[model samples]
Target chain A: MSALLTVEGLRHGFYGVQVLNGASFEVRQGTVTGLIGPNGAGKSTAINAISGALLPQGGRVSFAGTDITRLPPRERVGLGLVRSFQLARGFPRLSVFDHLMLYGQGHPGEGFWQSLTGGRAGRQHEERLAETALSVARRLKLDHVIDNPVSALSGGQKKLVEIGRALMAEPRMILFDEPMAGVNPTLSAQIAEHLTALNEEGITICLIEHDMAMVARLCDPVIVMAEGRKMTEGSFAEVVADKAVQEAYLGVRHDA
Target chain B: MLSYVIFSATTAGIYGLLALSLNLIWGGAGMVNLGLAGFFAVGAYASAILSLAGVPVPIAILAACAMGAAAGIGATWATVRLRGDYHAIVTLGFAEVVRLVAMNERWLTNGTDGLPGIPAPLKSVLGPQGFAVFYLCLVLTILVAVFLALRRLDRAPFGRVLKAIREDQDLAGFAGKNAMRVKLIAFAVSAGIAGLAGALYAHYQSYISPDHFQPLLTIYIFLAVTSGGVGRPAGAFLGAFLVILFLEGTRFLGHLLPGLSSGQVAASREILVGLAFLLVLHLRPQGVLPERIRPAPAQ
Candidate 1:
C-alpha cells in the first residue's frame, strides 16, 4: 500500500521534559492505523508533531511525498491534513449548526467585503454549504441539537461533532487524539464504525486509542511504542502477542 | 426642544458607532483593543487636516478611513504576536501615543487651540440650523449603514469563525483558518469604523482637539459594550443610546435638587453613568441584550 503519512526521527519536549524521542511511523492510504502506548509513551506528542500542532525541534514529516515539517498547522489543514482533540474542542456559545458552518470551505461570503455583496453565486454557495452541513449533522445524529449551543452537547455528542468538523474539511488524512474518551460503549462503537466507513471510502486515519479491544477490532497494522520509541508493528493480535509489547504494557495483564 | 432631541439622538448614534466598532474586536474576535480613541483621533485629524487643505468632504472621510485602517493594521503587525493581556496593554499605550502626537505636533493639530473651520458638506447649502438638522439625518444614515455592516458580520460565517478562534485558537487553525489574518482583518475593519465615527464627530462639531480623543472616550465605549451586551450589534447600539440617555436624562435633576448648581449636576451625571454601568455588570452581566448564536433549524 502507498504511504500517505511518514514521520522520521521526530523529537519534542516541553520545559526540559522530553515527550517524543526519535519516533517514526508510516500510515498507509485508506487504512485506520492505530498508535498504542502506555501513559507518557509519547503518543500525543507524536501526533502533535505529525499534525503541525507542535513543531518538532528535530525530524521531518512528509505528507503525500512533500515535506511539511515546518508548515504552520493552519497551512497543513488547508492541504487536507487535519487533526482532532481528545477533549473535543467546541465554542460553547456557538450553536452546533454554527460549529459545522464554520468549517465549510470555499465560501467567499465569509470575506468582509464579499459578505456585503453576496450575489447569486454567493447565495448558491451558502445553500450548498448549508446542505453539506445538514448532511453532516444528520450523519452524526446531531440534527436534534443542531440549533442548540455547543455547551448543551453531551460529551459523546461533542466527540461526534469534532469528527463531523474534521469531515467538513474534506480531509485526506485525520490524526485523531483519543476520540473515544468519555464516550459510552455504544457511542464509541458507533464512532469506530463511522471511522471504518471513512476508511473504506479512502480517507487515511491515524488514531491514538487506549481501548485495546476497540483498536484490535478496528485498526490494521497497529503501531506500538514504549518510552517514546517504536516497539513493534503488526496486526493487533501479532503486536499483542509480542513479548516486548506485553512487557511495555506491564505484562499485558494489568489492563485486563 | 424637538431639535435639541434630534441633536442628542445624533450624538448617540456617533457613540453607538464607536461602541459597535470596539465590540467587533472584544466581542467577536476575543481581542481587547484598548486603542479605540487612537483610531478615532486618526480619523478626526486626518479628515480635518485634509478638508482644511481643500480636499472634498467625502474624499477626506475616505482618507480618514484608510488612515485608520493603516493604523489598525500597523498595530496588529507590531503586536499580533503578543498574546492576551499584553496585546491589551500595547493597544492602551497606542492611544496615549496618538494623543501625545496630537499635542506635540502643534504645527498640524494646532495644539490646545484645536482645529477650527472644519468643513461640512451641507453647511453652505442648508445654512446653520437647516444644516444641523440635515447633518443629524446624514449621521443617522451613516450609523444605519454601519449598523447593517456590523450586523451582517455578527451573523456571517466570518464572525462564527472569529468566535471559534476566540474559543480555541488551536482548533481554529486545524479548521483551516488563518487565525492571524482573520484577526487582522476584523481588527482593522473595526478601527476603520471608529475612524469614520471620528470624522463625523469632527465635521459635525466644526472642531477637533486632542482632548476630544481622550482615553476616557475609550472607557465610555467599554461601558457601552458591556451594558448593551457583547457579540451582538444591536447590543452595542442599544448600550450607546442608553448611555447617552442616562447622561442626558440628568438634565432634569435641577427640579429634584433645587440647590444644586449646573456644574454640580454635570459632575454627578458622570458619576451616575459610571455607577449605572457597575450596577448593570452586577445585576445583568450579559448586558440588556446577550449574544445569540444564529442556527438554521434542523430540517
Candidate 2:
C-alpha cells in the first residue's frame, strides 16, 4: 500500500531542548500504524507535527501526495486528515450529541447570516447530521448519554466522545495520540476492537501508545521511535526482538 | 418620577444591548474583549460625525455599525494569537489607545470637548415627552430583535462551532472548523451590536464624549454579564437592568445622608456597587442563570 502520510526529517524543540530530532516515518494507506517509544521519545510531538497542531522546526509532511508542511490544522482536516487528543479534549458544556454534530461533514447552516436566518435546507441538513450522530453514538455505546454534557462523562466515555468526534469528520486518516491512555483494560480492548474494525473499513490510522500489548495487537509495520527519531521499522515482533530497539528502551550497561 | 423610571429603563436597554454583544464574544467565543469601549467609541463617533455631516440618522447608524465591525475585526486579527491573559492586556491597551486618540485628535473628535447636538431620530415630530416614549420603544424594539437573533444564532451550527472553539481551539480546528474565521465573525457581529448600542445612546442623550465611553462602562457590563449569567442572552438582558437599578438606587444615599460630602457619597456608592458584584460572584460563580444545554430532539 502507498503511504497516505509521509514525515521526513521532523525536528522540534522547546526552550533550546530538542523533543523531536529528525523523526522520519510514513503511515501507509489502510494500515493501523503504531508509533511506540520510551518516555520523552517525542512520540506525541511527532504526531502533533504531522497533524499540524505543532509546526516542526524542520520537516516535510505530505498527506495524500500533497506537501502540507505549512497547512493549518483546519485545512489539514479539510483534506480528511484528523487527530485525537491524549487526554480526550472536548467542549465541556457541549452534549455528546452536539459534540458529534459540531464535527459533522459539510457545514450546512454554518454561515454567519445563514445561521441567524436558517432555512429549510439547513434544517434538513441538520436532521440528517443528527441521524448520523445518533448512529455514531449508538455504535460507540454512547446513545444513553447522547445529551449529557461532555464534562459529566466518565474518562472512558470522554475518550469515546473523542473517537466519535473524529468519526463525525469522516476522515480518511486518523492520528490518535494514545486513545487508550488511562482507560481501563476492558474499555482498552473495546477500543482495540474498534480500531481493528475501523482499519478493516479502509481508514488509515497512526497511533502513539505506551501499551505495548495493545500496540502489538492493533498495529502493523510498527515504527519504534527513540531519542526523537525512528529507530526501526518492521512487524511488531521483529522490532521487539531488535537489539537497538531493546537498548533504546533499556539503557546500555556500563559494567558489561 | 415616571420620566426618571422610563429614562433609566431606556438606558438599561442600551446596556442590555451592549451586554448581549459582550456575551457573544466573551461567553460564546471565550474572548476577553476588554476594549469594548473602543468599539463603542468608534460607533458613537462614526454615527455622530456622519449625522453632523448631514447624513440621515439611520444611514449614519448603519455606517457606525460597519466601522465598528471593521474595528472589531482589525483588533481581533492583530491579537488573535495571544492566549488568555495576554489577549486581555492587549485589548485593554487598545481601548486606552482609542481613548487617547479621541482625547488628542481635535480635528476629528473635537478633543476632550466632545461633540454635542447629536440629532435624535423623530425628535422634531414627537416633541420631548413623546420622543422619550418613542425612543424607549425604539431601543426596546432593537434590543428584543437583537436578543431573538442572537438566540437563534446560538442554537445554530455557528454557535456550536464557537462553543467548540471556546472549549479547545485546536480540537475544533482538527474537526475541520476554521476557528480563526469563526472568531473573527463573532467579534464583528458583537462589535456591531455594541456599535448599535452606542449610536442609540448618542441619539438619546444628544451628546457624547470620551467620558461616556469609559473603561468603567466595560467593567460594568462585565459585572452585569457575570451577575446575570455568562452564556445566556436573557441573563445578560436581566443583568443589565439589575445593574442599572443598583446604580440609580445609590443616588438616594446622598439625599438620605445630607451631612456626607458629595465626594464621600460617590466613594460609598462605588464601594456599595463593588460589594454587590462581589456578593453575586461569591454566591453564584455561574451567574444567576447558568448556561443550559438544549435538550436533544426525540429520535
Candidate 3:
C-alpha cells in the first residue's frame, strides 16, 4: 500500500536542546501504525511536526503526496490531516452537541456572508452536517449529555468526544497522541474498537501510545524510537524481540 | 427626575455596548486588550470630523466603525504574535499613542479645546429633550440588536472555535484552528463595537474632546464587564448599569453630607467606585451573573 504520509530528516529543538533528531516515518493508507517509545523519546514532537503544530528545524512532511511542511495548522487540517490531543481539548462553555456541530461545520460550505444571507444550499448543507453530528454522537453514546458543557464530562467521556470531533471532520488521516492515557479499561476498549472500525473504513491512523499490549493489538507495523531516533520498524512481535529495542527499554551497558 | 434617570440609562446603555465588545476579545478569545479607549477615541474622532465636514450622519457612523475596525486590525497585527501580558502591554501602549495623537493633532481634532456645537442626532425633527429620548431609544435598540447578534454568534460554530482557543491555544491549533486569525477577528469585531458606542457617545453629548477618551474610560468599562460577568452579554449590561449607578449615586450622597465640599465628594465618589468593585469581587468573583452550566441531553 502506498503511504498516505511521509516524513524525512525531521529535526526540531527548543532553546538549543534537540527534541527530534532526523526522525523519519511513513504511514500507509488504511493502516494503523504504532509509534512507541520510552518517556521523553520525542514521540509527541514527531506527531506535532507532522500535524503542523511546530515547524521542524529541518525536514519535509508530505501528506497525500503534497508537501505540507510549511502549511499552518488550520490549512493542514483543511487538507484532511488532523491530530487529537493526549489531553482531550473541548470548549468548557459549549455544549457537547455544539462541539460536534462546530467540528462538522469545519468542512467548507458557508462563508460569513453566505451564512448571513441564509443561502438555500448553505442551510441544506448545515442541516445535513448537524444530522450527521447527531448520528455520530449517538454512536459514541454521547447523545445523553449532548447539551451539557464539555467541561462536565468525565475524563474518558471527553476522550470519546474528542474522537467524535475528529470523526466529524471526515478526515483522511488522524494522529492520536496517547489515546488510552488516563482512560478506563472499558473506555479504552471502546476507543480501540472505534479506531479499528475507522481504519477498516479507509481512514489512516498513526497512534503514539505507551501501552505495549494495546499498541501490539491495534497496530500492524510498530515503530520504536529511542532518544529521538527510530530504533526499529516491523511487525509488533519482531520489534519487541529486537535486541536494540530490548536494550533501549531495559538499558544496555558496555564493559572493557 | 425621570429625565435624569433616562439620561443615566442612556449613558449606561452605551457602556453596555463597550463592555460586550471587550468581553468578545478578553473573555471569549482570551486576548488581553488594554487599548479599548484608543479605538473608542478613533471612532469618536472619525465620526465627529466627518459629520462636521458635511458628510451624512449615517455615512460618518460607518466611517467611525471602519476606523475602529482598522485600529483593531492594526493592533491585532502588531500583537497577535505576542502571548499573554506582552500582548496586553502592546495594546495598552497603542491606546496611549492614539490618545497622544488626539491630544497633539490640533489640525484635525481641535486638540484639547475639542469640537463644540456638534449637532445632536435627529435634532431637526426632535428638539433637545425629544432628541435626547430619540437618541436613547436609538442607542438602546442598537444595543439590543448587537446583544442578540453576539449571543447568536456565541452559539454558532465560529464562537465554539474561539472558546476552544481560549481554553487551550496549542490544542486549538492542533484541532485545525488558526489561533492567530481567530484572535484577530475577535479583536477586530470587539473594537468595531466599541467604536460604535463611541460614535453614539460623541453625538449624544454633542461634543468631542481628547479628555473624553481617557485610559480611565477603558478601565471603567473593564471593571464593568469584569464585575458583571466577564463573558456574558447580560453580564456586560448588568455590570455597566451597576457601575453607572454607583458613579451617579454619589451625587445624591453629597446632599446628605453637608460638610463635605463638592470636590471632596467627587474624590470620595471615586473611592466608592473602587470599594464597590472590591465588594463585588469579594462577594461574587464570577460577577453578578455567573456562567451557567448547561445540563447534557438525555440519550
Tell me each candidate's TM-score: 0.96, 0.94, 0.92
Worst 10 residues of 2 chain A by lDDT: A247-256
Per TM-score, the best of the predicted structures is 1
Instruction: Quote fnat for model 3.
Output: 0.41
Worst 10 residues of 1 chain A by lDDT: A114-123
lDDT for each residue of candidate 3 in B104-136, tens digit (9 for 90 to 100): 989988988998766567798887789878888
Alpha carbon deviation, residue A254, candidate 2 (Å): 18
Q: Is model 1 an incorrect, acceptable, medium or high docking prediction? A: medium
Q: DockQ (Cα-based) per candidate?
A: 0.70, 0.75, 0.41
Model 2 compared with the native: what TM-score? 0.94
lDDT of 2 by residue, A83-157 (tens): 999988888889999999988867778888879889767888898898899989999999999989999999999
CAPRI accuracy category, model 3: acceptable
When only the first chain is scored, the TM-scores of the models are: 0.96, 0.96, 0.95
**Residue B128, candidate 2: alpha-carbon lDDT:** 88
Candidate 3: clashing pairs of residues: A144-B297, A148-B296
Model 2 residue runs over 4 Å out of place are A14-18, A250-256, B253-263
Writing each residue's lDDT as its tens digit, candidate 3 over A1-256 gives 9999999988888888888888888999888999987777789999989988788899999999899999988788888888888988877777777677666535333243344344666567767877887889889998888878888899998999889988988899999999999998888999999999989988999999987789889998899887777878999989878888877762442211
Q: For model 2, what is the C-alpha lDDT against the true structure?
A: 0.89
Ranked by lDDT, the better of candidates 1 and 2 is 2
Error of 1 at A158 (Å): 0.7
- lDDT tens string, model 2, B80-169? 788678988888888888888888999998989999999999899999899999999999999999999998988898898898888888
